[model samples]
Structure formats: structure tokens, C-alpha cells
Target: MAQNVKRRERDTAAAQVIAETFPPNVIDTLLAEAKETGTPIDGVDGLLNQMTKAVLERALRAEMTDHLGYESGDPSGNGSGNSRNGTSVKTVSTRNGPVDIEVPRDRNSTFEPMIVPKRARRIGNLDDTILSLYSRGMTTRDIEAHLREVYGVQASRELISNVTDVVVDEIKTWQSRPLDEVYPIMYVDGIRLRVKDNGVVSTKVAYLAIGVDTDGRKHALGCWIQDSEGAKFWQKVLADLRNRGVRDVLIVCCDGLTGLPDAVTAVFPDSIVQTCVVHVIRNAMRFVSYGDRKAVVKAMKDIYTAPTLEAAELGLAAFDTAFGARYPGAVDVWRHAWAEFIPFLDFPPELRKIVYTTNAIESINFQLRKITKNRGHFPDKDAAMKLLYLGLRNISSQRGGESGTGTHGWKVALNSLVNLFPGRLSF
Candidate 1:
């Protein structure tokens, strides 16, 4: 009984607030009409839909009257150079499905409707709906049919293409935007994409870089397409970064791409290039026998998890001693990457996680794969980049905002880097 009394008091307060918010009898009259006509108060083809159509039409009529400097049916419009010519029926997609309304016209064809512009078939958030679908790998034709089936709106394929094509310009601008002067760490990696070139389908590489800025924010720097991943191409990409205002980078974590370490040294001479520990382990596993794979991984973990650089070197020597005769190639892999592998061991665990691997960009590559998996091959380079740009934007948006600033445990990591690198990092 007491709980029921509290519920009733809450309900009474909400009703009082509603009554004070709207004018007298407005809510009651609308509810009564909805009941009298047996129409829903919300949803598509309901009272709200009817009211939206009515309101839009009435507002349009008011606009027409103002445009002509006279009221509807007023004698002052008789001699006016441009008078009401009647309305033409137009169906536009809206959040509440499609709305069919009559749009006013003028005699001289000079009065343009600002609310619903001429030749506009979509209003409000409908464009956003289409974009959201497109970013998820839906083709233009698929979006057109989806809009028709779900929203009861007939959108042409050309219209959908026009909407998605706008992202091309955005990609161009975002590709060349200036970069921050310093980033504590940057992750670089590449993903394969099938793209059509010269009327033949071929696999291409899309190089991506994700930078963790001063505030520990991760932002996707850029995407570059090439026939294959090579050190020369990476040199050009690094050059582009320098040109874009990246004066200093404390550390760059990347895979064991051949010559990548020398490339980093050439471009940002002060930056430490760390080979991805995860990649090194994975590469080493390929040379191990099926029966001994688990044991090999255990031995490898000791080297990476060691406390200090000297301890890590001892750990690597021990790993080589135990597995050296059985799997020389696996030991060779570690030896080849040893220079790049030892940098993270110098830092504490807080900073070690930031430079341990290229997993930061690897997660992004996974999402881009999911978005592009449906297509057998993109039509062209531009189409692939456009979709990629949109997919990155969508991923960033879902994470809360662009770059998703204030990475978890970032404050602790930043403090460590400041003391370790001294003047390199700017807060």
C-alpha cells in the first residue's frame, strides 16, 4: 500500500508538470481526438505523423504568404507581380517515415522554399540514416531499396550515390590536414583490400597510422594505398608526416617490416622504433613444430616479460640455448629484430604497454575489414578510400567522439614518458 502511494504521488507530479508545460486543454484535446478517431498517438501513420504533415504544410503556406507580401485570398495579391500559383505534391523522407505534403509555388517561379528546398527529396535526419547505412558496407542500390522497404520512401539509386559521394571531398581534406607537433607514440600497420585497376581486380595494401597524442588520445592519422608494402613507400609516407608538422615522435611501434627501422631513423632520427613484440612472437611460432609450439611460446614470453634490458637479453640468450638447435629460424627471427625489440624493456610496465605492439591500429584494421568484407572488390581507389574514411569516422563516433580522448591508463603512461624522455614530450 505504501509503495502504491509513492507511485501515485510520482505520477501526479509528472502530470502536473505536463499540464503546466503545454497550453490549456491542448494535450487533452489531442488525446481525446486520438481516442475518438482510434488513431495511434505516435509511430508512422499515426497522430504525430498527421500533425507533422499539417504543421509543415501550414508553415509552407505561411512562407508563401510572406514571400508574396500578402495573406492567402487577400485582395492585395491581385496586382502583385508574383502571387500564389497553387501547391505541388512532394513526397520527402523524414524521421517519421515519408511525408507527402503540398508545397506552395509562385507565379514567376522565383520564390524558393527554404524549409524544403527545391529538388530536395529528403528532410531532417533522413540523410543521416542513409549515411549510417552506407558506412556499414551497404551499397547505393541496397540503401535505396532499404529506404523504400523500411521508411516507405522511394529513393533513386542516383540520389543515394549523390549522398555517399560527398564523402570523397571529406577524405581529400582529412588526408592532408596538419598534424600535431608531437605524439608520444604512433602505431603503423597495413591491411589488404581488393581494388579494381585497369579493368582487372588486384589486391592492394592500405597503410594506416594511429597516433597517441599528448592527452593520450588515439587518432587515425591517414590511409595510403599502394600495390604492396615496401620500405620505399613507407619513406614517402613518413616524409608526408614530417611535412604535415610532426616535428617529434617519442616512439613508433610497428611490425617487423623490412628496412622500416632504417626508414624511421632517416625521418625522425630522435624517435625510438620498437618492433611489435606480438608480431615477433607470432613470426617465431611459424617456424616451430606443431608439437612444440606451446612450449616455444612459453620460452619466448620470458624474454619479453623480463624486468630490465639486461635481464631481457639474458632471457633471449637462454631461449636461444634451449631452442637454438631445434628451431634455428625462430631464434634467427628474434636475433634479426633484437635491436627494435629491446626498447620497450627499458620503460616501466605503464609505458611498456603503449609501445608493446601495433595492436592500436590492428584493432582499427579489424573494424575496416568487417566493413569491407561484403564487397568482392571496390570499383576504384577513390571508392575504397571513401568507404574507409566513413568507416573510421563511424568507429570513432561509436567510441564517443573523434580520437576518443583520455585513453584508459593514459595519465599514468604519460607521466612515465615525461620523466624517461625529458624534453621530447610536450604536455
Candidate 2:
């Protein structure tokens, strides 16, 4: 009896390791079937379905044997009360197609199969399929139609919603999770989306923050939904980051939102606030004509790309002289943002590139925009937050599983940052 138990344990362990190479005989049989039937090997009635059925049935059989503590027809099981009671036919939907297989039963009726649960009608990681589709911005109705048409599975809208609803709690936990003690670089920005409230649709801003750790790997700190972006709301966001364990941030990159720089320094006095150069340029361009835009852009590049802070100021002066009269507002933008913008001019190119703009976070916002474009307007705040959270998680996976980006030339950038901020950047 003990030997039988040990052998069963060995079998279970072996079954857990999926074989990379299948038996040659099985392949030959499948090929022969396809040739004889003149069917594609990967179609509904093809090798995948056959293999899925065989693997599921085999797993069920193994489960039954484990449950009974003895193999079929073993004399040691002659007096065992919970003996095999054969199997019942069960049809399950899979990615390939519908597969009908046998589910083993026990005499005592306690054999619960894990591969295909007692009532599970569909298989092949369907929840993941729904999430992948949902993260890619598909509506639940769209996902339902996609499953039904592509996989021949009749999934209801409610079922699809329930699958994605699991992300709500995940978002809550992720938002409040503890962060690293210090981040080398941080970028914050807002993207607008519509949400419904009290039967009225209003535009709301989704504020996102991305932090680059000491290792130079980017981590999406969190997302916040607000009626509008302001320093008061940003103070709250910064406080939350502090409460969650972020002690110091070397630099905070953001747009020229009024009082935003004060909010950053208020929360982390040691942190330098760097206004995004791209935002400054865009704001300046807003007041320029299409014809003069090229010349203006060229002049503006001289200021930002200057080798020294004094040189950049000279470049800005040169720009003011050339276009200041016609595009005074454009020149004023540079003048207003000059203090926050010149910080990059003091750094080497490697470090400057890392902190010059909030482009890293903007890329993430672009992806979220794509996800929410079809949404029109979310029914409520949580609905909007849930979808955005899932979208970020999906985006992170696509960019090599990091919350932000594994920036190219990160090693060189880190070395430059280390030399620039003596005691600030600790591993």
C-alpha cells in the first residue's frame, strides 16, 4: 500500500512537468488522420483539439487514480471503498474549438477534476483571454462577440464584465502599495478623459506618475482621477507618495502647471523640479504661425540644446530678438519657464536626456488614450480608474514587464546622474 502511494506521488510529479517532445507515434497518428480527412492540422477537427482532449482526459484519469489512492485494476484496490465508477462525457469549449472528453467519476462521487472543473464548460485560460482583450480597449460586448465568433464560445456580456471586474480590487491594492525609498527621476502628467456623473458627462483629468529607480528601471508610481489638474490635487498626490514610503526624489519632471513646482518642493524639499522642455516648446508653438513655426522651432532648439546655461540664455535672447515682436506670447512662455527649464542645461547630455521631458509618461498616456477612446465616457469614476489601471498593467507587460521603460543607455545615464548628484543617489 505504501509502495502504491509512493508510485502515485511520482506519477503526479511527472505529470506536472509538461513534456516538450511528444511521442513519435502520437504525431504519426495525428498526421495520418489529417491526410486521410484532407483537413488542416490546426483546424477545429485538427491535431490541437485531439491533443487537448487526450491531455484533459488523461489528467482526469490521473486525478481519479490519485483520489482513490490506487491505479485502475490493481488488486490492492479490490476492497477499496471509493473505487472507479467510469467516466461521463463532457463537452468543453477551447481556443481551438469544442472538445468532447470523458470526465472520470468515483463510486463515492467525490472525484473533483482540476483540469476541467465539475461545471466548467470552457477551457484554455479564458479569463486571461478576456483580460488581454479588455486591456487592449475592447468593450465587454466586443469581447463577447470576439469569443463567440473566433473561439465558438458563447460568452455573455455579464460574464465578460465579471471577469474584468476582478481588476478593480487589484487596482485599489496597487495604488496604495509601498514604493521605494528614493527614485532617481520622476515624471508626472495628466491626460483628459470623459466620465459620467449624475447624468451629466464632464471631462476629467487622469494624473499619472512614472518614477525611475536607482537601477534606472522605470516604475509607474500610480494614477489619480481629478476634475482638473491643480497644485492642490498634486500636493495630495505627492503626500500619498510620501506616505507610501517615497522619502526622496532626485528630480521631478513635469509641465508648467501653475504652482506645481512649489508642490513638488513642498513634499520633497530636496527634489529639483524640472519643467518638461517639450511642454515648454508646445506652449510656445501654440502662439506661433504655421509659416514661422519652423524658424521658431529651430531658434528654440538653440536654447534647450545649448552647451551651457549662459549659452542657453543667450540663445533665448537671440530668439527674443528674432521673433519676440510678432510672437511675444511665445517668447514670454520661454521667459516664464526659463528658471525650471535651465536645470537640464547644467547636466551632461546623458543626464539631460533622462530629465528633459515627461515623454516616458506621455507614451503611457497615449496608450491609455487608445484604450479609452472607444469608451466614450465611463459610467463612473471607478470604472474609468479600473480600465486605466488594467491598461497600464498591460502596457507594462508589453514594454518588458517594467512599469515604465527599460531606457536605452540607462547605464551611461546612471553614471552621469551619480556624478551629478553626489550623495543623493544611493543604491
Candidate 3:
């Protein structure tokens, strides 16, 4: 009964408190001012920050009054142990940019301001604002310039780098985390980033593995920057994936790289390697002569686009007779890669469309390029890796389903995979 009476008293006093705090013309005055200026009254360079400063200052004064048990300018404070000191000037960064405000202080340093606490350099949301920009591929230099021009804040390059460096710990944690046991298809590819290694600056390759689990959701397995591209390094990459908990992979799709098929088999011996036929066609077309290019491209499609491998072989032999004499190097390239190429032919058409090309990985590489294009070269391998990881994180945040789990095209691919491999997949 006592709790009920107290709750009723609080609910009834709420309106009385609001009436005492706000004037009837306050909203009207705001609307009239907005009409006269033709500019926004709330967001970005508006009266919002000024009003916020006024409210915070007022609250600080109230806190001081309560602390002293007397009102401002009252003689009652003479008996109190501590007295009011002059306000201190402090600037804090926020999502709305920077705001300079006066903070109240006490003579004995006993009063700890709560509105803008002591030693609080920035508002909580400001860090997230900086991180959002960094994830969208804005370089630290660009972020510094943006903060200055738009938010009226002078953020040093080091300050901006410091904000992004927080992610390095999260990245380390994510890389070693456990993965799904089985992935129906995995796309492996490398994107180039210019990095300084050991004293010399050169273009280095960063390897990425994108796995599509049974639920049709795509998981970015991991990304790593290697000193050089070699079979030994690739083997280590595969070993790392195995260590993370990838027990079975049905097919690994990749562009033509020397000895990569063997590398896949070395890691998951039962995993089928599907060399991108689209890459083969494009590379072969490069070797064909100009006048013959059109005729050669149409004929080349006949070999891989055929419904059956038997017919594809007949088309392959005809292609050899038709243009193999002139483009013998191209012919040899196809013949050498044929062992890896036929794996796609063995699968049904639904499955073939996926494993026959590295389109999945290529799309991801395109997204990474959007972020790295402005950078000429990173300071080191870790620097390059950080930028790429942020780019991937941003893309996932922007397009994943519900809680940002599955990508857009991945659902369609998973639906097809479900029909093709009914028993081997699990969400």
C-alpha cells in the first residue's frame, strides 16, 4: 500500500514538473525562428548544440546547489565546508562534431561533474562515428580531413589511427575463432595491395577464403597477407583453415593458379578442385588474333558451355583444328588445366554454375578494391590487412540478412546447393 501510494504520487507530479520546466510559447518560438531563417533548427550548425550547452550548464548549477544545500548567490554557503569555484573550459568531441562548454568546479575538487565527467575527452558515440567512416574505406588521412571540414574538429592523423587500431585486437580474435564443420562450396582468391616489406615496397597478395555453409549463408573464413605467392605459403594457409575446424569441403572454386589444385587436395584430400572455366576462356581469348577473336570466342564457349563432357570434348578437338595452329600456347594452357576443369562437368548444371567460376570471390575482391584504391601503399603488411578487414566488415554490416548473417546472392546459391547436395549440408 505504501509503494502504491508513492507510485501514484510520482505519476501525478510528472506533469506538474514538466509544466514548471517548459513555457507554452517555447515550441512556438522555435517554429517562428525556423520559418524566418529557412535553415534547420536542430541538426548540424543549428541551435541544438547551443541549447544542449545551456541545459548542461543549468544542470551543473543545480548539482552545485544540491551539493552545497544553498542556491547561487545565497549567503548560506558561508557555513558549508566547501564553496563554488569558477567554471573550467573543456571541449569534447561527439557524433554531432565538437562542442565547447564550461564545466563547473568546486574549491576543494570534491564535486565530480556528471553531465560531462572529468577527463572525458570525447562522447561515447564519437568513436563509433570514426569507426563507421574507417570501415567504409576512408583512409586515416581522409578521416582527419573530413572531421575538420564537417564537424569543425581538428583530429590529428595519429588520433584517427588510434581509433582504428582498436580493431586489431578484435581482428586477431576473429581469425582464430571456430568455423562451421562443413561448407558446401569455398571460393579462394587473392587481392593485391601495395605494402612495404623488409625495406622494399612492392605489390603483395592477400589471400581470402569465402565459405558457403549449408544454410546458404556466406562466411568470410579469413584473410591474410603473405610475403610472397608460393605453394608452400598456400599450404600453410590451408593448414590454418584445417586448424580452425573445417572438416569437409565439397568443392573449392578458384581461378587458374599454378599448383593450387594440388594444394587444395593436400589439405582436404577428398575436396574436388574446380578451376574457373570463365578464367580459362578469357585467358585463352587473349591469345587469339584480333579478326579471329570474335569467331574464336563463340567457338570457345561451345567447349565449356556444352551440356555434356563428351560433346564438350568433341567441341574441344574441333576448336584445336580450327584455331589451335595459330594459338597453340592457348591450346596447351587448356590441355594442361583440363584435369582440374572437368570437375565442374561432373556436377549437375545447378551445381556447375557455382563451382565453374570464381565469380563469388571476384565480387568480394571488387568490394575490397573500393576501400584500398585511394591508398598508394600501406606502411606494412599489418596495415594493409587492417584496411582490407575493415572493408569486408563494412560490407557485411551493410547487406547481411536480419542480424547481418547471410549475403544477398548467397541465399540463392544455397537454395540450389540444397537441392543438389541434400544430405551433405547442415546449417
Candidate 4:
């Protein structure tokens, strides 16, 4: 009898301890202690799971009540209660965790979220990771490994491709968006890429036009892919520019592209087309011997660095006299391109500094090449366009400022133009 009484007392003590340890206040205290100690509680993962489930359930219930005009939980005490349409919720497994999301019901049933709307499934931090990788020029396989190692989540190439495909429509819209009326200066250039065409690989040219508006902000006008670039195709491009709202371009800087000057003249009658002096020099040097290149370059510099058109002409005469026999082709190129080169000289020195070269477009192309460094070659025109568009989009946000010495010179030159053509120039 004595032993039995002792055992009952021991059982009572154990029951009291269990009741005290699991009280609401005790659980709160334990949670605070775990937080302070930076430790996970034993067997608390299940508790966390339950808590998350309950929170999600409550949220879904509220959404259904608000949107479907139906109350959740128990009905009125009467056997029959107000009837309403019921909505179904689905559980979606995601990289972060599992979530219960409500499905939308509409008459059309074709609503697709472009930017990932709320209550979406199979979407989480993975999308952000993929986009970040893409911006940094990571390929699909690289992104797959990165996610596998960082989040212990395996992502397939098709999934990554689909995620990136969301930007295609956006790129199309941006390509067709209306441009500003008057760009103070416009830079035109082409970048070449190897793409598969008709089941055979070939080289294709991608033309890009970048413009700086009157307000000093840079804008990417658009991009086009073609088998080649020439006057006729470029005329179409110019007409497209007009249709897209580019009314006036005061100056256009470009390389020695065939028929380009005529095309520009046809579109913007008042615009001055300046052939890039740097391209002229590069073309000139090709005709000179390696041993005489240094001397030839020195002579070329005199032609560009001359203070006035007459000075430049004198320099050119001297250059032809010195190197004509050795590099007749080089001198002829200069003479042939001189009409385009001399337009900048008609403007003030400040204006000449900006329009004398196509360096602005070249700088942007350099960044583009960096983005395409690892791409051996594109499979098709669409693939090449996609990569270039992504790079442009990433760089587009940084469009608020002038980039180089040329830009500084442009500011001064534009101010002078504004004073000279007050009615024509608008900021």
C-alpha cells in the first residue's frame, strides 16, 4: 500500500511538469530563448510546418470570402444555410516551400501573368536567381549548377528558357515604342554574328541605332537583323524611324557605309552626315607598309586635328604628297570620304569634337561584345536578337548621363546649336 501511494505521487509530479512546459506562455518563452541563442528547437520543424499551413489556410479563406462572396467555416445552426459558389485551392510545390494558392476562374480562362502575379505556383526565389544569372551573361547550364549548389534545387534548361522567354513580348513592345522627335546627335553602326540560316550557318549583320535626345539622355532607337546592310535597307530603317516619331536629327555619325549618307539626307533633309574620322584612319592605315605605318598615322592625324577646313585641306595635300606613291589607296580613301568628313568642320570646335567620330556607338558595342563573349555563335537570328536585347535592357536603365569626353563636348556644342538655331532646336 505504501509503495503504491509513492508511485501515484511520482505520476502526479510528472503530469504537472508536462502541463507547465506546454502552456502558451511557455511556448512563447521557448521561442524567445531559441531566437536569443540562435538555435533551432528539437522537433520544432513539424510545429513550424503546421503553423505555416494554418496561416496559409487562413489567408486563402479570407481571399475566398472577399472575392467569391462566400463565408468559410461552419454554416448557420439551421440545417439549410445561404448557398454560394465554392472555389478550389491547389497546393504548389516551390523551391522555397510548399504553398496553397487559389485558382482563378474567368469566362475566357486565358489570363496569363507576364510578370508573375500573386498566388502563382512553381515560382519563388528561383526566378530571381535565373534573371540575375542571365544579366551576368551566364548560360543555361551555369545557372542550373548555381541553383543546385546554392538552393539544393535542380532546375532544367527548359525551365530556365521558359523563365527567360517571358521577356520576348516585352522586347517586342520596347522595339516598337515611339522615339523622341529630335535627337541632338545619332550614332549608327552594325555588329556581325554567325547565325544558322536555312539549315546552313552564315554570317549576319545586326544594325543598331543609338540616339541622344535633346535632354542629354541616351536611348537605344532599335535593332534590326539582315543578310547585309546597304543604302536601300537603310532607307527602310530611316522610314521606320520616321514612322516611330523621329522627326529631326541634327547630326548623324557613322562609318563609311555604302549609300548611308544619301539615305540620311533623304530622311532628314537638314541633317549633317559625318563619316567617322577614326574609321577613315583605320581604313587608311591598311594600305601602308608596317615600317611606314607610324609616319602615315602621323600624317593622318594632321588631317583630323587641323583647326579649320582650309588647314585640314592643306594637311591632306601634304599627306598625299608625302605618301601618295606608297599608299595611294589610303590617300584616295581620304579624298573620297572628305566631303562627309568636312561637314563637322563647318560647326564650332565644340560640335566638331562630338561629330568627328563614331566612338559613342563603338563604346556601346564594346559592352555588347563582352556580353556575347562566351556565346560561340547564335543558332538563329532570334537567338542573337534575344541575347542582344537582354544586354540592352540591362544597360538601358543607365541611360541618364553622358558617357565620355565626346559627350562633354556635345553639351557645349548643343548649347551653341540652340543659340544658332533657336527655332529649330528644342530641349
Best by TM-score: 1
| Model 2 CA lDDT for position 361 | 89
Candidate scoring better on TM-score of 3 and 4: 3
Candidate 4 lDDT, 1-427, residue by residue in tens: 1222454588698669767857989678868876787655432233343344554555555554554344545454224333334445765434444445444432333333332344554543457567657756788888888776654556788988888787788778877888888988889998888888888888888888888777555667889888887889889999999999989988788997787898998988888888898899999888988999889999988988887999999999999999998789999999999999987676777777777777788877877778767777777888788878877765653443223122565567778778755677765
By TM-score, highest first, what's the ranking? 1, 2, 3, 4
lDDT of 2 by residue, 112-171 (tens): 889899888877667778888998999988998998888777789888888889877778
Superposed by TM-score, candidate 1 places the C-alpha of residue 41 at a distance from the truth, in angstroms, of: 5.8
Query: How far out, in Å, is residue 244 in model 2?
Result: 2.4
Q: Estimate each model's TM-score.
A: 0.88, 0.87, 0.82, 0.75
lDDT on C-alpha atoms for all candidate structures: 0.85, 0.85, 0.77, 0.72
Q: Scored by Cα lDDT, where does model 4 land?
A: 0.72
Error of model 3, residue 129, in angstroms: 3.0
Model 3 per-residue lDDT tens digits across residues 235-333: 888888889998888888888665667777788887888888988888887788788988888888888887888988888898899889999977876
**Count of steric clashes across candidates, in order:** 0, 0, 0, 0
C-alpha lDDT (0 to 100) for residue 338 of candidate 1: 92
Off by over 4 Å in 2: 1-21, 70-88, 307-314
Candidate 3, poorest ten consecutive residues by summed lDDT: 401-410
lDDT of 1 by residue, 238-353 (tens): 99998999998889999876666787889999999999999999999989989998889999999999998888888889999999999999999999989889888888998887
Cα error, residue 82 of model 1, in Å, equals 1.9
